[model samples]
Target: MQAAEADLEADPRVAEVVAAARAADVRLVRFEYCDVSGVAHAKAIHVDQLAHKMVEGVGLTRAQMALNLLEQVVPIEGMEPVGEIRLVPDPTTFTVLPWSPGSASVLCDQLDHDRTDWGACPRSFLRRVVDRAAAMGITVQATFENEYYLGTEIDGRFEPVDAPTHAPVYSAIGHDHLDGLMLETVDALTAQGIVVEQCINEYGPGQREISVRHTDALGAADQQLKFRDTVRGVASRHGILASFAAKPYPDEIGSGAHIHFSLWGRAGEGGRSLLYDPAVPGGLSPLGRHFIAGVAEHLPALTALTVPSYNSFRRLVPSAWASSTTAWGYDNREAALRIASPFYRREEASYNIEYKVSDPSANPYLSLGALISCGLDGIQRGLEPGEPSRRDPARLSPEERERGKVRDLPSSMAEALDLLEADAVLVDALGPLLSRCYLAVRRSEHAAFAAADVDFEIRHHYYRF
Candidate 1:
């Protein structure tokens, strides 16, 4: 066994995990990982074998990373079925499945036979980015504000629960309609240690948005995975289908998993907000402006990671509140980035930027990691974000947009992928192997959708995310 694998066996946490499982009567422990397609896959072991498996991890074929949403394995070199990798669990993420009886789960990091981080592991990629930020004496805190739909399947056709009468956006009546499911979901999430901050009925007929408090960059991604699992699991028990698809119904408003982020100084440097400066106009520090500038500069390529699926484009249009241009503004929903208003008397603690273009179809780890990479590059170059738009860039005339340096985001998955391939900063952040495999998988999906129809696109993406 490798030294790191051996060390896992000797760690006291293994025994504690085993004893806790026994006490809780957990019959199986699932070692889970979110794939490049944002789909969660797992291999469960009998409780009796938990300790041994925790150390050695469950073996998986390397080709897993090359698999697209359609389950086709793209032909990426070195990511074939001939090699193997391990799913090494992070014990801190171990949580009993509140929605699934007699089962527990632990998030994992993919490692090679020698126990080194595999380049294609999304979790490991985020770790590398977090380490990079730490080297610069900065820390990132973030959360994914996910909006999803609640529906039921009838005769293989999915229909929203509020199909007959659309609930008004943010209406109390909508909350009453899904009260039981929403409350149980919140309880389940709390049971798993995730702090729920808000729940509301969204603009779509049967859409809902449940948000959680922010955490350290890595934990934020892990929490997002847990949050998705819990919401879906609980909804299933009620015989309801929950979807985080960007556009679940062609005629309805789309759902988004907006990202809220802030940077901070290291604990040694008083751990104050690096993005806050009360004396400055808009309460945004110079560092915050640079970070936003970096994201704007790379917004075209960044969309390939954030709004990844072909279905995502269905929602990212002008005046849709999903953002269509590379513009930042104070509370402007039509801009890709929004500088949120800080709370009264708590500006420093509450200051953060919201990336509006992201969706639930994205692998949280990859999107967050790529975001930090772009922001860091901005800091390194001292880039300025220019003027914040008070009106929608899409509403401005072509001449006005050019004068303001505003650019439109890619309108389709294929276009976004092309931008990503040509971007040196993002490609370098993903590293060679990961960039190659990710592009291969996404390209395969885009090709498949290109050959198919709109119904085919909606069918595949609806429940998968």
Candidate 2:
């Protein structure tokens, strides 16, 4: 479904933000977006200056490249002349910066100097994949599960809040400590046409997750990126910080952008999600089986796309809900591929799956596009995906694991990139020019791990800050 038009027609709550921007004479309208690496950044110009340059776009030197996730500038040929990038805002993305006093926010696309899509831009990259899917007469609908940490004021220092000393799940602890800020975050996101289902206190001290219920791959990825910025923006208002570094703390779970999705062919659609089959003992259709099979088989290579950081591997250890192995299971949370509950008799929306390996560190566009590629490959080849990882992973015996034939994901960014380089399918899917640049960035990032003993936050953010 498209973005809700209703939210765009100045609601009272949003009107306040509009008035504030106007009253402040916010001369420039800024369209904010991130590149392939998860860098929080923006490109803006004055109102009068906006129209004149809107079509021409703005430019930033390629020298601005950050290490995988860190904000530090990486060494690149400063003369490469990446040139001007056009910024087109989705009016519906209008949301005032919750933390930036008198400032506002909007989502953007990076275009070439000639007004064409910028292949290297993350949003543009994802948009291209979505367009390709559209050409095939099929559609993918998705939502984001934003997992993160919450630091509260304690003796004037922002620290992890006390855990609720009880069973924590869903929205149980959502309003206990972070109610006010959480509500405001939800409100601001809602005003931006984001359908946030609910907020929850995730496992680990000071950890929380906001589950956004949305549709379409592009919209889901966009909202995920926006929410990352929104959380940081909102937390700053309370003198706290929201970190998206994969594994910010050794003892706590790192943030993740876990995605849930279903696929269909136009109107009547793929006649029901190929991934679900109530007819089977576990309810996975033949087509779905092929898709999951593709995912499982290519997961080793998919590592470069899914868990795309050095520290990202640190969080992949067992028990953190981060799947260390590549396996699929029906309703099994520990497996790398988690299948959703069965949709019985519903001919349109039954089967679906979640790739548990991806983190907030991945370039959503490239990674998700790669997932579609590998899955479709399995479908074309009639690949039959394996059964679920039946035993509790934490207690699985060596024989059981061997019998399950489960393989583990790479332990580092270096290994993942190697796998990606070896995979012709994925490289072709991502495009040579983009793959070369993408792989080049990762290699440089991998080398930095030996640069020094970077802190958890730095290790997690070194590439995309």
Candidate 3:
């Protein structure tokens, strides 16, 4: 039976999607979203119910947003299951599941029963931040270069699918070793509307990085969710697992979801890169300088969102290639923020900034929202960051660091939460409810990790991704 388009009562795009799903004989649909813990969750329904589900939305427990990475509902004071929220499907995010048979998926925005945005919803908070940037005549474009490990479980131990001695950063032999999985991953991501610019074997054994083309801010975060799903699902199809844990093994390079961003004026006549100017020193426009300074200023508190998990801190050590110091630099990987200049083109379109402190376990929406809000704060206040560092902050002498005003980021999750609480602007941007709940949940994770072994935690996270 054909599902009537108008009967769906959602946006016309949603109606068209439902009609298409019916025509394609899709048996089930997955309403999917990322929870507060950065874990992707879904509620599946038969295709026959798509029409009603689109308008009414599938019911999800309010406690879903209060859970930790282990699916345990964190004992946050205001986030108990005294209520429910609706997962309203976003038609713009609908896509057919390439790996899962006879099933399609769409992302959703969490809402109260009255259809108003939920304060604790990460996706909604991201949208609010995006709108704030819009009101200021600014646009944020971003992309995530995600790195993950491919491994298989054997007799309760996780082992890499392919191992090579020493670091093979972009080794052709390493890429060829997993070329089948990489090609399949590319195809799967392409099918889901995520543009894969390139994929390669990274420095660590069994580690790989995929760089997707950048888009608008919100779409960038949405694509990250899809990218995670695509990589994990495609790997499983090839009889292996893809783990995005910040540190799946001790003594190995951890995976990161490094964010690259560029600021632009709003559409139409305002369209232009605000980060580039030929007249400025280092080609960084004044507005861009302030934005970078803002990010550098608030980076300590922002780490609570970007590197939320306890495992994330393991990846941010002195020589892990993930920056731990609050400094910006020109193409310096050891700095928290790096100014990326395009080698191929000297144009504004190629100018951008890269934030290297974040890991794959972070909620993309929250991470990106915090970043945009801080950059906007910089632009408004005319904050000026000092000269960019030429050397890795970790490798600098104490006198050199003091001279540069460079400081180490929070060393632990507890310390990061402290910084987040102390930062007024970041707290306001996240709103009280979200800030409170996030702190409570993250603290619990931290405490849990302190009470357990690192290997135990690694095992707990490795297969879940």
Candidate 4:
């Protein structure tokens, strides 16, 4: 076989994965894929057929890509249920579920009828973006600090597992209350090769943040998808639901899947950071500055993907530490892009950019992919992000913001969608087909929110994600 074909087979790792599953006594294997709404869909196969299914993949409807959070299919052309797509198992993502006995799961990539990459597949879109970055001699590393609410459904109403309205952030009481769930979650994730750096009780009642170690961009995105599933599944074992809704409670701080990223070039044995240089101002290398500039230039339209859901906008206002402004600052939590600099220990590799606008409701693959696209555009054009401020952009005078080119993010999903529709750069990178599919689902989602009450909408979207 040729080198390219051999490399393609490496992704499935069929023989090795099948052996591992058998040794683990995994009777059923779930082929999982995330839809446009960041909702997971799965198909299970018996252990006896796991090997074959890994090679051939499982069949799913084309309409799966068009489904909204409501599970209703949006009428996008060429996405009808009349056709089938293959959910090809990715061997590297295989994980045995500690919460579900005799079962294992692996994330899949969608393949069309002729075995070509599917245009509407979000996972595939991310891979293409990663490949583009690689061609430019850049490597993207990323991780998500996911904040989520641990609550229970009592009498059809959601309540925090241990509501601590007045308790201090990272309070011991809430941590001790949910100790079992948190510890078990760490163990389960560690067993699957996912590094859990830390876990803490966030400011909101029952809200917890689990920080994971950053990895290659593709691996990081896949790890996040698994992290969500692992957290929810482990929470289910404890008899409570773990909801990743952008805003599970209207009055409380919403959960965010804040992303931290850096760019790198190859070095001996591993890679060297390309985003940092102690000699430069703010320790930002030229490549790093250009990349940040690209992100700022595209952020207005990119909001449609990063903060995709209608509820997502509710959490983007000022002082929430979820900056809605399209600006970057050193250590500024109020900017959409916050540059982490002057690393005390490892200055070279530690400087990175934190994108604070996204929530857990976003599909990690597409969001991260779009991020890479913007960064690449910046590098190619040698863009400059203007200025970096420690002060909040909202506090800046109108003339000051205008001079610095700082701007606010779209106030609503409708406005964000409109911005995305007109951004030729982003649309080209996302490809016409996937872009159209995403727009259809989000547009329908916005309309649904317009027609529903807050309570009804929360109930409709809370758990499935």
Evaluated with lDDT, which candidate comes out highest?
Answer: 1
Clashes of each: 0, 15, 0, 0
Q: What is the lDDT of residue 401 in candidate 4?
A: 85
Query: What are the per-residue Cα lDDT tens digits for candidate 3 across 1-465?
Result: 334455555367767878878776788988888876788999998888888788778998777788887777887766788878899988788788788878888888889889988788889999999999989988899998999998888898888877545346887677778788789889989988788898888878888899999999999999999899889988888898999998897778889999999989977966999888878767789998899988888999999999888888888887677999988888888889998876566567889999998888888999999999999999899998866788878778877776666888998989999999899999999998888888888888788888998777888777765
lDDT of each residue in 153-175, candidate 1, tens digit only: 88877899888898899887888
Model 2, TM vs. native: 0.84
Find the 10 residues in a row with the least total lDDT in model 4.
3-12
Per-residue CA lDDT of model 2 for 1-465, tens digit only, reads: 222223324344334434555666666566777655656577766544443333344566554433345444554432144544456655456555545655666676766667676555666777766777667665778776767776554553335655445235554544576778888888877755678887787766677778887578887777777777777777777877776667766656677777687767775653445455556876767777777888788989998887787777878877677788886777778788888784456534645678788787776667787787787777778887655687556667777676666787788788889999999878877766567767877777677774757563353562242
- How does model 4 score by TM-score? 0.96
Candidate 4 residue runs with Cα over 4 Å from true position: 1-12, 164-166, 267-270
lDDT of 3: 0.86
lDDT-based ranking: 1, 4, 3, 2
Off by over 4 Å in 2: 1-27, 65-68, 71-82, 90-92, 98-102, 152-158, 163-174, 268-272, 342-350, 394-404, 454-465
Give the clash count for model 4.
Answer: 0
Between candidates 2 and 4, the TM-score winner: 4
lDDT of 4 by residue, 187-237 (tens): 999988999999998888778999999999989989999999999999998
What is candidate 2's local distance difference test score? 0.68
TM-score, per-candidate, Cα-based: 0.97, 0.84, 0.96, 0.96
**Models ranked on TM-score:** 1, 3, 4, 2
Poorest stretch of ten by lDDT in candidate 1 = 2-11
Superposition error at 163 for model 2 (Å): 7.6
